[model samples]
Target: MSSIFKWEAKPFFDMVTRRQTLQAISTTALPALAGCTTDILDSGKSQTRYTLNIEPIEVSPVEHALFDPDDDALFGNPAQTALAAILPDGRHTTYGYEPLPDDAYVEYEGSYYQTTNLVTGRKQMERTLIRAEPLPDKADVPNDAILVDELNRPAARVVKILHSNAVTGGEGNSAELLREDAYVLRRPVERESRLATGELDGRIVTMTDGGNWAYRLHVTHKRITETAHTTLAIEVANSHSQFRDVVFGSRIDVELTPENLSADVRNLLEDAVRRETYEETVPLPETFEALLTALGLKAVDTAVTGKLLWYDGELYRCALYVNDSS
Candidate 1:
């Protein structure tokens, strides 16, 4: 397949926990774990049964020249063969020579194909369009906000931490919260190559389309290290298997760079960026509770009050996390 729903790829997650089980979606019935218990889903209470199904997206050698700034992208494939018009008798030919609907199929040589997507090739009609976005810098936390890889390594540059908002008991007034991260790479024909965080059981992600590339979008969160008086650590990385216990003066010196991200992780991030872009807005806070469950994150110290989401180079206020560490 070419793409997935908005919440398919979870960037900031550790799926190798002892509390999860693998299940086949097609063979077995999916449990209704949407709102059962946050303990197992969030704070690692019991265990979770979830997996990520990721697909690669095609990216033009040149950036999207016609895509709008507000538009988010998941994936794209270039239309080959010249345009054509479908005749009442099933004949197909080039455009401008004959009037035709945007979605009409065209013929080339001896074969017939669909018309090119709008604003491309002929720059006329709308094609398959969706909404997707990858990691963008948060305007509030320009200095503190950092982009990391799947290994929780810094994928982008190190911004100065002007004010700490990714800390406990604080509003994200000026924080570049981790919202979405894009991974670009070859199509994940194998299980390990796919953009997955939790239990993926035995599903296969095959790239059937001629499009050779793939992209995935992920909303990953970095580990939060808080001290009673000061914030010690706040960076995205898959360093620890789980959230490190709230430590007092000690801070783990993570020196990982973007390149340090595993090949699969990086590919997942890029693929997310190329998939799609949409304009519909959802209640992030209300949906974030389930989102954390999907990602397999637990709450520590204090219960989750609210979250900060990074999108379109801005941080949006979001929902609370887990209630307890089960």
Candidate 2:
């Protein structure tokens, strides 16, 4: 993500004066801490803040699945066997059957078939089974029967798998099939409270002359206190109109320090920020990794709040606010 500093000299000085005035009044009016002198009054209080105004010639949206089942045990089978079965109507059909699951079912042509008396060996793999029963007719099929495609995989656009027959060791119980797919393509409706206690890295860029001039800015924040609350803002400069129709977004990965947290806490925070920010959108900027490398700092955890605007042939400014407190 890229960000541009938007401060003007006069306004910046004015803001500082205002903050100083407020600080003076508060310090004089507020009660003093017990056994503490004015010199140490700022102890235990800290803050960090930065602002950026960005103009982009283009915007883009990033799409991601809430949950992907490609690596899930119940959703995938490796080295499985595909065999042909004769239906009650004497029609030949082919399906996939795995030796791992006890149910011994075949999936083919958009349906499941229950298999029995299967004889198997290196050369006997082609022998006919004594009985292969197709699932109850679609009319009789339970309302909850999982909809599988012609490939026998869960047919719905599955976002999550809440409960599954494979997971619970059940047989022929359609209700036990994974139903989390009911929430397919659903967006999160709530924001979760999370902690920012690790390193963060991001890119910065600047553009001027109405999409004709562009350059990068290197930023680094070092010596951040352990367990500090960190927030990130990304700014983008669109110097060309070539990418006008595309939407942009960010993917952030934070590696936590195992020694600094307990297992439970680590798990809770590992992807906490990412889950919330994945849906947020952004633009292009300088490489944050380069900035960190120059500063001899490592990348860590962060949370993102995104703002996007459409370019209207006028100067567009997007602002992202970062507030760090410890």
Candidate 3:
């Protein structure tokens, strides 16, 4: 639920006059309105039908991370398992050794060694290395080398070596200790934007998936005898509804005024204004369809133009305009 404040409606007679001039030109110069007669003296009077125009809206982008760092398959150590060899009769021959693959290089004894002629059980479950060749140093290892842990499993690629230290073993042999970059093995962030447009009950509606969410334009017309009425409803919804409770707040302030309108048309516009204004707090609806019902705004036979201001908190967000003349 949200609070709505009602304010006095102000008129913009200049815009109304401009709309009237445009309507006159559209009716006379355009073939669509041909055969329509307008008496100069009675031009101030309202007529029966009007036109509706819609504009395109944009949505902001959202970002998402691609990986979780705590997964065991990417971060766990595999050096605890014992190496074994598979016999021809399915007997197991266990060996006290690291399970590295043949030709695989590793930084050992302060140098690099390439294993060769590796012997292993089914599915490489047990590995027995025949021999290894000495390499110059870690500097010789390729940046895109196939990295593997002690158990011969795939290891995350190292992006950058932050720090390195030499560790002395019980036999006085030295090994390299490396500090890897934090972003190594992590995928890049992805940004997404979603947009949709459709017609609902003759009204053109466009939706944006962001804080400034929905934009809707509705136009309707009715005719009676020699008089005609046209109504335009411009609706905007922010992301503060029930589905987007994190948006904090949203507000829409609308103003409408009638210019050079006949007595009957003026009365109709006044009634529509009264219906559109809210004097009590109302529950903020989730969907635009529910929002229209909550706001009590409906299309009626009237001649007027409207100005709309949308906001979130004290910041001015968006604006929409409607010009109706008959």
Candidate 4:
């Protein structure tokens, strides 16, 4: 975004345009690979290393169940499914860092409704949403359940659906995707997109920022035709606040698997990956477990390690996967 200083000149990265992005990975120091979509071909040299870690985020049992996503149970209907289709992987799956701060509301097309019968004096419960939120964040909202943000801008769909019968009152069940990994208002979707994700079912072991800036990467896996892409929704609260456009683009590959990983780490990865097929929001296998972990991630991270290398002279971003059919 800034012209006064170039990315290759500086020690960090910034959001870059397609023209500004280079196809070559410069190697004055560390042996590196090239391109955002290219496979990692550098065979490990003096590349910058970042260790992947996942710590437990504190939450009440009730809160955890309410906010966390379900792995096995189908979490959406036709409307919910339609809306989720437009989301960029990590946004729908990424957990909220904060508990929505109470008083806050998201755009929701879903709500609890009950109908009463005049003759029998009976009540029936149902869940429904017609069109759904327009933008990935929120665009032209046609649903009454859709919500708006502080600026009255359209926001993510968060619905508290109710279920009950004519006899019982109702119970609340929410189908929400708390996509707060990035600053939705300040850094809108237009400027950012999912890059790559390196995940394992249990623990994630990959490269990090090497301790310059604190960042959170919400990795999302996407399959395009025959190519598998791991998109990273990188959210950073950087200490360096001068630059507004910061983009860390790179790839992530599962370097090691459970069979080749440390015994303790392997057990955790296997358990987390397998358990997800039937459940959601599991306990952390190990604090700061090196490598990768996430949904559909177990298929990628079975006893694995992840390595990331940034191009040119920049650091921060890491390596991800690209399924090579040939």
Candidate 5:
């Protein structure tokens, strides 16, 4: 006659790996941050502050389920006996047992028992607590068909079997980790009208003779306040159109909101933008000979001109190879 048995082995450390993975998935949370903007200044004059508000984007959560494991073979066989094994405490070795052909067994409260199945014409052995450990101090157990922790938490112990059946026991559940947040992208919606003297501060204009000139542009606004993520465009115009072109660099203090943007991140983007804007041309001493030698030119007779252009979205290019003698 075929004999039946049951047993439990540390709930199978495999379950431990699965639980750890679940725990990890349960703890990952990332905050959705937003809001970015830039302002432009015209000469010495500043633009009025503006505010813009828009709809916010909302985030949501995802859900799923968990499964239990199987535990069998410890109570159906008669020859099964508990085998001493290492426990979690290391100081003590616990015993684990399964059914065998020679002895009938049953298990309860760390004990074993053997019985006969008269209807089935067979014998069975079982283990009550072959390998059981105390619940973690921070964990709680729960009530349900599934084995849970002290906190009514499920699946503290699990044993997986064929066809994904629970030959033993465990809990299966899923939960969300990241909380929901909203994002709002705003642009300057309105501006206040003010009188201007038509002069901008800290601006350079060239004279008809190609001489350097400095002009202070006047602005109507004394201060400005703007909402986050608002980009402002300021137009620079020369009433006199005296200079063929004006070339100069200026600095302005910009305030950014920390609510949605980190300082380090904004700083990084700003540094990159500044690096691409200006060219630190190292002019070869007034000596044309030095220029020829530096450029690897065969002679100083060739006139070399450099022009740089800046495009939207940080795009830039140089026309260094503009001439052809082929």
Candidate 6:
């Protein structure tokens, strides 16, 4: 419970506080204009539902580790036991031997037990070797093998913006784009802790079982900010013979670092993305529509596009050709 509390404290606080404030403000302000156009909002023509499409988001410059509860449980346990083989019936027992009493011999009926060396008196028990099978040998490997697997494995990730107006269907703006298809590969990976104080990486990760200690991986959504405005640079180029607006199914998710994202444009992006992604089908666009409905701005609506990149710790080098933003 303490761990869960710690893991989700910020999100919970943000949600609770925001809800209380909104409720209080709505209560104070609603009655003033309560009767004006109240029924008009529910009318079919005025209440058109818009689909929000989001792009798949990736953790840029993938980090080394994350928090793993499964590994913690396994490694935290103190008592360690291993199944060992016992010798055959033709065994000799010297002094200090603790033989199982005939009445106490129900469990391991055909097995023989010998006592430990009286000098240490560790109460060690030895069984006669029957036919214990050994585990197959695995070749030596490194913990960083997942880096190779990511290139091959089929993975699911979330890509969309997050904002207050995303799912809330009122007269307010929409949500912002943050991430896409955010998912874990098989088991998550981990490593030594390296996060800001009071913050933890709760992403499940995994690695090849070679080293003695299983290292977990931590990944957090990061933003490059220069003050109040958050910035995200995307690379787009002209791919076709001429400039054109090509709208493929897309969505984006944005997770603020320390959960502090306060930008109208960013929020709109998230809302639009969420609405698009939560749809049964995503529409296609040939020309970039800057003012698609009353939603957010299309930052990049170029025909020539760059390759979709993942976290590999290198500058994403690709062509750039501008297209219509409106």
Q: lDDT: which candidate is best?
A: 2
Candidates ranked by TM-score: 2, 4, 6, 3, 1, 5
After TM-score superposition, the amount by which residue 273's alpha carbon in candidate 3 deviates from its true location, in angstroms, is: 24
- Show where candidate 5 strays beyond 4 Å: 1-227, 240-243, 247-289, 292-326
Error of 2 at 97 (Å): 33
lDDT of 3 by residue, 1-326 (tens): 01111312234344468677567545545553332333443466644332221111132110010111233332321211111121111122222222223233222223222233323432222111111122234444433332222112221121111111111221221112121111111111100101011111122111112212111222122221111111111112222232122122222232123343445544543443444431211122233223232223324233223322221112122211223333
Error of 5 at 157 (Å): 48
Tens-place lDDT per residue, model 1, 126-148, is 11111122222322222222222
Better of 2 and 3 by lDDT: 2
List all candidate RMSDs to the true structure: 31.7, 29.2, 32.6, 26.8, 46.1, 30.8
Q: lDDT of all the models against the reference?
A: 0.25, 0.26, 0.24, 0.25, 0.22, 0.25
Compared with the true structure, model 2 gives a TM-score of 0.16
Q: Give per-residue CA lDDT, model 4, range 241-291, as digits (tens).
A: 211122121122223444556666555545533442212222323421242
lDDT of 3 at 56: 16
Which scores better on lDDT, 2 or 4?
2
TM-score of 5: 0.11
- Alpha-carbon TM-score of each model against the true structure: 0.13, 0.16, 0.13, 0.16, 0.11, 0.15
For residues 128-239, what per-residue lDDT tens digits would candidate 5 score against the true structure? Answer: 1111222332223322212122211011111111101211222212111101110011111101111121121222222112221211112222222221211111122232
Model 1 residue runs over 4 Å out of place are 1-52, 55-85, 88-101, 111-326
The window of 10 residues in a row where model 3 has the poorest summed lDDT is: 187-196
Q: Report model 4's TM-score to 2 decimal places.
A: 0.16
Question: Model 6 over residues 1-326: C-alpha lDDT tens digits?
Answer: 12222344456467668778567556655663454445444342322222334444343222111111122211211101100111222222222222211111111232322212122222232211101111122332233332212322212111011112222432233222121311111111111112221122332222323422122223443332211111111112133211111111111111222123335534544554445332111132322232231222234343223322211122121222332221
